[model samples]
Target: MESAVEQLLHSGTIIPAHPLALDQYRRLNENRQRLLTRYYIASGVGGVAVGVHTTQFAIRRPDINLLEPVLRIAAEEIAAAGLERPFIKVAGICGPTEQALAEARLALKYGYHIGLLSLGGLTAHTEAELLAHVRAVADVIPVFGFYLQPSVGGRILSYEFWEQFVEIPGVKAIKTAPFNRYQTLDVVRAVASSSRRNNIALYTGNDDNIVADLLTTYRFHVNGEIVEKGFAGGLLGHWSVWTEKVTGLFGRIKNCILEDYKGAGALLQEGIAVTDMNAAIFDPSHAFRGSIAGIHEVLRRQGLLEGTWCLEDHEVLSPGQTAEIDRVTAAYPHLTDDIFVKEFLSQDSIKKLLLHA
Candidate 1:
């Protein structure tokens, strides 16, 4: 079967970056010299999730006036990781138009080639005003518009609204996290088939369907021969491409899709199964338990992340659940880290340290 990795090699690219925080934003400018040097270092780059910080509901990370620190870290990390230019996603904060403009200016100053702006609190009634504000920022630096879904945050955008947004200059890519698989596929078809081409890259933020959407489906093509099957190309949920297991799989899948579609389809099914099992550890209610954190926790269980740990708010496997993950991890073998579950700390110990339940 073709893994997501294989399919990606043939169709498109993946860019990965760490989240940015207000407190750490200063590092962007201060670390510029070092980061710039490091950016050119031989690297392996994937997708980056910048702008937003993860914390338990109680405490949000600190905010900084400038985003240079975070951008510097991101550019350096992506460069070091051997990825192409890193992409940035703006985190939404309650503020006046001045604050929004400041964030846009930060993005421009830091050399972020791509941007995803989350305007959650901005109302539809103010949609025209927001677009004008976004355009003002875009004049300085390019930007992507994302209507963050209710699952993450309520509806900040609508299809009619986005149709208007796509008209803005420098509005290149969009990260769409739809309510379900069908809605996701619908959006992909719409964007890929849209009249506007160059400034728009359709990114599927819908975790469950990323593999299938990118690796199997056929969007419209000018050539009549074989409608190319596979991802519209943007970003997958964190875990889908985070670890070597999933990332490696995607790398392989990229190549396989162009050579053999059937093979890629099979690999995607397997990948989804592994992801499903991982998500199941948290709860049946939550479809995806934040992919990065989940993968980090699983890796933590096997002792791969080493001193690194899953951030707070990350759903953890309970003591009773540990044996299950251990068993599943062993059965899969693809996620192997060769550590005895017996030696590891209990779920209670892990939970207490990770975040209050």
Candidate 2:
């Protein structure tokens, strides 16, 4: 990794899993897509992860062919912003070795800083096969391992799998989102056991336990030494919506770490509130069938998107999911950024920002 990129990655910042913006016809809404990128930048995200799960992996299908286009759109928007500080660009890399390698190359071509390698589809492969797959892509670009929850398309990756994963020379970080406490600890302990542990960053993808993951410290005894690790930040789907509030919440969490603050009572309460909101937005009730549409609904309601239309007609919200969303928005008004987004859309300067090529 470049020194600056490595610095920002380790320093801990909010990186939202960028979503795909589409028209009612389910075509790429380039203008709305660019506008969404602008919203993330304006909302103070440290970076954006494009072509990831939140963006819908279906985009990579041969018939759809949206992976490169979406990646290029985000890259262009980031470049047009001309940020003074380093901003991490993570491109999601999926499929087998050959395809994953091709995606990595494409991501690098577009100036992405890291490849978030997803192992969800390769569940049938042996651990050794999976490791080889990881190394092939890692050799092409710095990698961020993803442990997607199985409730979606993900399969369960064992601790043994992650133990070897951390040893890959090009692996730079891990986004632990198994949504299982035991599995999350496995990633932490695996990194702790590595000689290059300090070089690797751990980020929480557990939207259900975002606050607690950020607040707790994971300590392990390795080589008769105490090795402590905590989530540097999050690379989350939940953060993709209500990002301004997410940034502020992350700032407070980071401050708590810096000060070694002991008063976590209030923060823990906030965590429950966040989990409640996530249940509504993530639709945990229906095994996350509505997760993507749930995200779109929030953006649509805020006018960042035209509507909650997904590429597949069957991918719409689950029955009563909208009512659940309504309940959370009304219940946790502080968590939503409706006012911030409204003000942002009204700004003449933002209009000019969106006009950039």
Candidate 3:
């Protein structure tokens, strides 16, 4: 494992949403992207995951191709931020093996450190086929396996699939975001059982179980001795919203773990408020119609976003989602770090981005 990736992967990573100009649909708002990168770096997040689902990868089609531009500007923004610690810049990779590897190479060219491989485009694939796809991509650069939820068009992988995944050369990490306990454990167990177990880092992408997942100490016998394991950290869409506060919470949790503090119950309890806010935003009632909108609304409130607009008109907040956002903001006062982003917000940039607003 590369020392840089090993160092950066051992902490929480935030996935920032692509901020569009207030009224312009499908536009990549570069100024806001810079500000977001600045804020995320200031908040002490260990890394950033861009071009992922949270950034609405759906918009990066062959015609428009926002992927390269977004990654380039983000690198520029990171240089502007002058961060001391190296941030793990991640590029989300999808489609077939050839396309995915091409994207991975582009990401590396644009200063991204790892490819968060999403096997969404290759539908009706077998485990062997998927394994081949990942190995081919990994041949070019380091890779992270993603078990995205079905709700978001993510194909669920079996433990058998994960076991094979962990053994793949250059498969450096796994983001377990199945949104199901059994599936989450399947990935964890796969890592635990792999011959290259020590070489692979496990990160939780299970937003609903973020805190508990971090607190858990998974014990298993990897060799003659009993080997213990746990998630090194998280890479979450949920973290994009309340970022600074979320970063602080992550620090506190990690501190407790280091000190072996006995307040596991209280630590897990803190997740409920965040989960409540997630429920409102990720509203299961509407199948998350407002999920992205709800995220934008939070950022808009913080001045990280220009407005709650999306690429597709129907991508706007679900009905009553604005009210739900309001309710969570009121109910979870401590959960927000709006002032953090607001403190450094550029009204001049906002005005330039949205002339009529």
Error of 1 at 170 (Å): 1.0
- Write candidate 3's Cα lDDT for 193-303 as tens digits: 888888888888887888888888888876677777788888777877778898778877888888886777788888888788887777767976777778878887766
Worst 10 residues of 2 by lDDT: 348-357
Write one digit per residue (lDDT tens) for candidate 2, span 1-357.
678878989988899999998877889888888889989999999899999988998999889999999999999989999998889999999998889999999999999999999988787898889999998888899999888888776877778888899989999999998899988988899998898798899999998999999999989999999999889999999999999999888888888777886557777899999999999888888988898999999999998888998887778899999999999999999989999999998989667644641
Q: List the residue pairs that clash in candidate 3.
A: none
- Candidate 2 local lDDT, residue 325: 94
**Candidate 2's TM-score:** 0.97
Per-candidate local distance difference test: 0.47, 0.90, 0.77
Selected candidate, larger lDDT, 1 vs 2: 2
lDDT of 3 at 131: 94
Over the stretch 239-284, how does candidate 1's per-residue lDDT look in tens digits?
A: 4222345445656666676686758757777767655565544333
**Best prediction by TM-score:** 2
